[model samples]
Target: MTETLASTSSPTATSGGTPPPEAAWINAYERLSPRWQSSALSPQSVIPIAISRVNQVDAGRLDIEMSAMLKEQMVKVFSVMKPGLLFQYEAELDAFLEFLIWRFSIWVDKPTPGNALMNLRYRDERATDMRGKIRTGLEGPGLTVYQKILYCIATVGGQYIWTRLQSFSAFRQWGDSEQRTLARRAWLIVQRIEGLYKAASFTNLLVFLFTGRYRNLIERALRARLVYGSPHMNRAVSFEYMNRQLVWNEFSEMLLLLLPLLNSSTMKNFLSPFSKDKASGSSGDETLCPICQTNPTTVYLALPCQHRYCYYCLRTRCAATPSFRCSRCSEPVVAMQRHGGSVP
Candidate 1:
């Protein structure tokens, strides 16, 4: 039995007694199984996933800005028309902008501006077959003409129709109609549909977190997946500048919070000795009150310190605090004297 097994294995083995390289490789690949092969071609890491989300947000923001600009220009052209007349067509304007984006981007087989910047493009998962070796794991066929049309209909047309329907329903007070009425029933159905859509979107989000495939309901329903556009390119977006901007914003916010609690006079007195111009002494402009930084109409002098101040300003400060000090010289003010005469 051992001699018969050796003769059978000899045909597959090489001269050195090891099995041929090609045969060994084929056997190893076969051992992977279909399940393992699918797992091997799983979605990308967190970076790409996060970038895809950022791209979606960016695209939405771009659409909003473009719509705003177009609306502003239209408003200028129709300036003579009744104010807020164009506001009635805001939904139409938004739909037009969305259509323009779809026509230029998805319709032309090119990625949206945001997706292009992030080096990502949408791929039709329905038509893609994961049989061959995927070099960068991003290799897939672009969306077909049918998929693109459906995407546009689902996103642009669907949104416009839903918005107009809601507005019309609300305008006609359908929800307030008799409970048994058709209008009331239609309103309830719309609300239920909206609720179902929201619930489905939440569930899709959970699935996306684990699979890193579809980021939104539209993509999942359309079978369109975002993938890397360039196989050789690295991540296009950089967080370094954003990190620095956040740091600066936090620092500024901290300063804003702490600034109100600080005493400007105390800080000036504390840092006065270190000032380079300290030895220069007070300037010749004695008419100006150091506290208010204005020329006082009725100048009053602080006793011992002899620094000038507005009468009301000095009186208010002295009354507010018994141990009021000179704002300029930082000396305790024992009495107030008029600029030209003594006052008790």
Candidate 2:
């Protein structure tokens, strides 16, 4: 599991990688009253296709655009949903599947034309018909038996492929024939391991559903990061709203990194969150620290009056004052927290 997470770490660059299949997974998730077709392609493309789909939701005539979109999405849904055919996080899975195909293609079965051993393509009539069904599948029932079988194969094969055994030096050391034999043996062993892992995964999912935990725990302990967003989070929604949270994390990190250079006086002013009681000042304005009696260079903490103090000054005076009260207001300082940016 640790290795699987490590091997599947997405490249920071988003330029080249394909997105995950969400619509298909969603359709698969809720068979009843589904809003959209299960796409066979990249989820990124689904947005445009889905928009067009909404535009033509009235079962309009299959014009060129309609037909093209349907066929394209069907192809994507078909190609993407296949066993061990993933373009992301499936490098190991695909590599291992390649070895399996290599072993199968040997001993009377020749490797297919225009195909690599590590990756196999199946284009039999059944495969074609199944894809066709997916395109028009909603008009009838959900995925057929053949489709279910494919998903089952895909699941098991995906779990096995998650092992990333192909990258192992020992596996590469084996000669072609030896590797084929080993593939068969490894296939059997993986079945047992897959069952165990699947059960563990199901249990973890159950725990996560109940407790809202697991990913964060794994991220902390094993650094096993998520390739996609959290399941509990809203999918098909804008993440721009999280820009604040992102900025906060970055701010916190910067604050920590700069902490060593900041002393009590400097730190106090920088994080000065409190303010003054405006009524106390005849001018109702404060421009300098009352303790220092100088203009503010950074954030000057304000007392409950016209008098201002650097965060350290007021906090120091407040502490020495009776019952830790503010100097200007003389109000009981129940609590104070940091606030404000540099005031220049």
Output the TM-score of candidate 1. Answer: 0.68
What are the Cα lDDT values of the candidates?
0.78, 0.42
Q: Where does the lowest 10-residue lDDT sum fall in candidate 1?
A: 44-53
Best by TM-score: 1
Per-residue CA lDDT of candidate 1, range 253-301, in tens? Answer: 9999999999877889889889998766757665588777788998788
Candidate 1's C-alpha runs over 4 A off are 1-82, 175-184, 234-244, 282-316, 319-323, 329-344
lDDT of 2: 0.42
Leading candidate by lDDT: 1
Per-residue lDDT of candidate 2, residues 102-148 (tens digit): 34432223322222211222222222233333331112222234543
- List per-candidate RMSD values in Å: 7.2, 29.0
Compared with the true structure, the alpha-carbon lDDT of candidate 1 equals 0.78
Clashes of 2: 10
Question: 160 in model 2: Cα distance from truth in Å?
Answer: 4.4
